[model samples]
Target chain A: MPEKPDRNAIEVRGVRKVFGTGENAVAALATVSVSIRENEFFTLLGPSGCGKTTLLRLIAGFDYPSAGEILLYGDDIAPQPPFRRPVNTVFQSYALFPHMTVAENIGFGLEMLNKPKAEVKARVAEMLRLVRMEQLANRRTSQISGGQQQRVALARALAPQPKVLLLDEPLSALDYKLRKDMQIELKRLQGETGITFIFVTHDQEEALTMSDRIAVMSAGRILQVGAPRDIYDRPADRFVADFIGESNFLKGDVTGTDGGRATVKLSSGTEIRASLPEGFSPSGSVTVVVRPEHAQLAAADGGAALQGTVENVVYLGTDTHFHLRLDDGVPFIVRRQNARGGADSFAAGSRAGVVIGGDAAQVLRD
Target chain B: MASAEEIARAADRKDIRDRWLLSAPALIIILVAATGPLLIVLVYSFLTSAAYGGVEWKFSPEAWVSVFLERDIFDDTLSLADANITIFWRSIKLALMTTVVTLALGFPTAYFMATRSEKTRDLWLFLITIPFWTNLLIRTFAVLQIIRNEGIINTLLMKAGIISAPIQILFTDTAILIGMAYVYLPLMVLPIYASMEKLDFRLVEAGYDLYASRWQVLRRIILPLVKPGVIAGSILVFIPAIGAYVTPSILGGGKNMMISNFIELQFGQAHNWPLGSALAITVMVIVMIALLVYVRNTGAASGERRG
Candidate 1:
């Protein structure tokens, strides 16, 4: 079979999932539409109760959307049961069958599909090798370590050769070290299997490191869908900026506009240039988002630079954090690298100037 | 002043002694009150039966011999005791059937209860155990009232014109089976429910995600995971059912006698106390063997799953 690089492997069209009924109804996904390309590593990034897992469940056919369609390679699978779908999930808990051996767990999908015995054996052996768990094939899942159990779960889900593999926080249960290792391992497996991997996680770092593109969701709605660099460098709004990374929100008024760039007047009467959101024309007050690392401390020249008093100085090995109160009494944080001979040791209660880097400030539309 | 280590050791010894003293009463009661009658019955099995309804203090294996073999009254030849064999077969068969029927009924009911929300689960469990509040004999009689010729089932059928006359459901093996199953259903349900309630339902979701149908998920995952509870429930129901006295006597009408009823007859009408004791020992042996076989089978099954 030839792989179509440009075609969509799965498309969720205007999907809305409302749980419960009447007064108790809660919308977990509200009119969401996104397309996952073939063999692409897609991620749904959100915090708890943000409906990222709900979207993944809809794609895997474990859940049905209240109001829209889910298409797997052009065929609508919205009403189909999970068993009937050609997709599989790597659950957060691993969910390995405790009674079966690792090999049997890996072979379960094939066996359920009624594949031939020899075929199942061969596929299971291949999967065990792929997951680097050949030595633990005969071991009961209960006897395996958590990380090893995670590998077995991955092997089991991949053994079915699903069209799209939906991973629901598969590494959330692992320790920090193991989570890092599994993240790399998951990316490698996705590349090798050439399957469209739709991963869900709340860890922005994990999403940024592993996903080819991420859809940042908040409160049952997709805030922005873009590459990690695109999302980090140019967030669509204050919520996306705040959710993906630490950002300082400064209350500002739009003083002037120039195409995609706008001049915002800060409370301290300092006018700074910020990039505007697409097609948003702001005339009143706005929120300017600036990442901690985007601003640097300099001599308080008292001109064209936002000045603030250093409230706290925290040394954190590789970087030092300067928590300062801006002239308007708004708390702002600036992170400076602990480079040798390049450190600006500012004492607490000392006045400092924060020079916002060019094109780093993002003017929010709302 | 005594050394600290020596004082700690002495305190440990005293603690051990105190613990033993505290538990001694329960231990003594279990040994004497529980196993005391069983020991007497074991001893009586090897002694001779009195002319009336008691044992004679003389060593004899006649009771053990008569358990499986009896001398022909007219021919002076020993042969298999057909009546004893029949009663043993009936007892084993009914118990096995009752176990199977109760498991078939209890498994889904337990699963249903286990799947319910926390507040409602207690309600379901309470409902399952409601039958236990009544006396066992009364419960059996309640079943008799339902299945008897002039009882509710027959009257309903006659009224509905489904039958011209009442069905002779009572005084039959079916009646005893129904009664035993109803009586022991809670025993089967509770243990299985305990295991099922602890089950992680995510495993079922994983099974479905692996393309397993509903039936396949139940057969391959759910059933195997809950096997220990099934085995426990089966043993709980089967052991008492094999030796049940009341349900058989009431619903089977004394004609279809179980092993317990036969053993009772040996002491009452037959005046064979030694035979009754021997029969009781035999039932216990059968139960032990059944338990061993059950354990072995499940152990092998689990090994297969691992493999």
Candidate 2:
């Protein structure tokens, strides 16, 4: 279908992939569908074997969905092979050609496209510059370090100006400092090129740092999709809240709702007010999800709170974590800002009262 | 009591002595078996061949000259009608052909083996090596039965109405080449398979991701990467095939002589010790040169790999 390049870059519709047959069957992805906007830095973030990489491979045409279609610019490209697709992948291993020089590796895609030699040279040079690897253009891949090889892999993929660039945990191989630097570089690259990037990663922080939007996946399904702040602020379920960051869940039943807030009655006869997520009914079973940083150890005089013994004290550099257990056998953790003497004020086995603010806790459907 | 430093030094010395002792047996065997015979060949190549089979122990260039030039007893002139050079060139030609055939047959099999599932790959590798367990001569003899007149292949073809008579395959250069290639097939396949098995197919995926067609990927990426293994396997086949004595004599029916058969003739039938020694020394020199070239190429390839 004829369409503008600025249209939706990718639309994976009801895609499913099963790896084997009979007793050994593995459903790598199941009826997963998402729309990735053109020029958006989209990430599929999940733990390993969560089907994020499977979806990326499907988009890049390295793999085909067992059912359903993947459309590129409104064209169903599910039947197409990888080389025929408009998408390129920076593989997780950086899979740079060992025998070729960095320049040759970068030019390979352009040459495969049958571009004129001069234009190929110009584009390769531009890619090398974009990756900040001009100095390493002549070096063979084996002569370079892992970080340099990573840049070469990027340049090689970007040389042909593919409409959609797929990256599979490209920073997983880097050290902490290099990963930090690359996260920034990747955002800049995505911005400058305005190419749709479907990046697959298992790192929540990396997804938050680089992506315009992220789809959190688990057990071969997309749990939620939103901007980083939206995901961190309002997780859709217990899994999303727990997977994204540290969160404490208190199993409760919603007792009442007023205006936009919900009052959930905990099993221990304590009640906490939380904003009810849409589709959650009053008087139904719900889980109140509170980020550890949102709950704090309060003074004994604070009203309407759960009092528990501090089971463990962890003095993190910027924050101290209190692992608390209520007398009813419910365990939860509280993270507070370690300002001056604020930390080390609570000793293990000491009694502490934790207050869960209505604005800080979220009511999840499940 | 000795100081700690002195104690450590003594321990280090003992360790060094132990290391030497561990390798001493193999080293002594190599010296006696390899270097000792090589020395005899070097000396005997320079000395005169007696009227009999033994060396005369006198300085002479006759044996060396016989490899390239022949004395004209009637006209006192040197001509290049030497049978030794012909046999030498014939051996090189046969070895080259054998190497080419083995590579053509081996590379695809190795690639096929590499692509199989791990358990299937083991089975195929074992099958490729099965021929090696049998003696080379016995295996060649089996091939003779298959290709010879009134042999199994001919009987099958005749029974199937495909041929009225057996084709003239035995006792030909083609047969010799077939025998050589068959003998060296495993040598070629094993190394090429090793390299193919070690290949990072992720690079092949990367190639396709970068818009390379399957042909382009195979030619530009797979071919260049697997060349090192092919070269290694080629050397393993070529060097041994160049000095091949049994295959040609059996397959060539004692008439189609190679340099090795000529060397044998000089030592046995012709009873010329010095000429035989010279030919043996020359063959060794050629094999050594081939080895140096292979090592140089492999060294450069590995250096590039380190990049």
What fraction of the true interface does each of the listed models get right, in terms of native contacts kept?
A: 0.94, 0.81
Candidate 2 docking class = acceptable
Residue B16, candidate 2: alpha-carbon lDDT? 99
Off by over 4 Å in 2: A1-6, A255-263, A268-283, A295-317, A320-328, A338-358, B1-28, B46-52, B55-59, B159-162, B290-307
TM-score of 1: 0.94
lDDT of 2 at A58: 90
Model 1's interface RMSD: 1.0
Instruction: Give the Cα error of residue B55 in candidate 1, in Å.
Output: 2.8
What is the Cα-based TM-score of model 2?
0.87
**Candidate 2 residue pairs in backbone clash:** A141-B307, A142-B307, A143-B307
Per-residue accuracy of model 1 over A1-366 as CA lDDT, tens digit each: 244488999988999999999999999988999998999999999899999999988887777899999899999999999999999999999999988889999999999999999999999999999999999999889898999999999999999899999899989889999999999999889989999999999999999999889999999999898989989988988789988888999988998998899998888888899998788888889999999999988877655368889999998889989999988899999998898766567999999999997787998756
Which lDDT tens digits does candidate 2 get at residues B1-307? 9999999999999999999999999999999999999899889989988776888979998888877788899996889955767788888899989999999999999999999999999999999989989998899998888888878878999999999978888998888998899999999999999999999999889988988999999888998899879888999999899999989999888878988888889888798988889889889888888789878977887677445
* Candidates' C-alpha lDDT: 0.92, 0.88
Question: Mind giving the per-residue lDDT tens digits that candidate 2 earns over A255-340?
Answer: 89987688888877888888876665667777788888888787554664787889999888888888999767888899878787
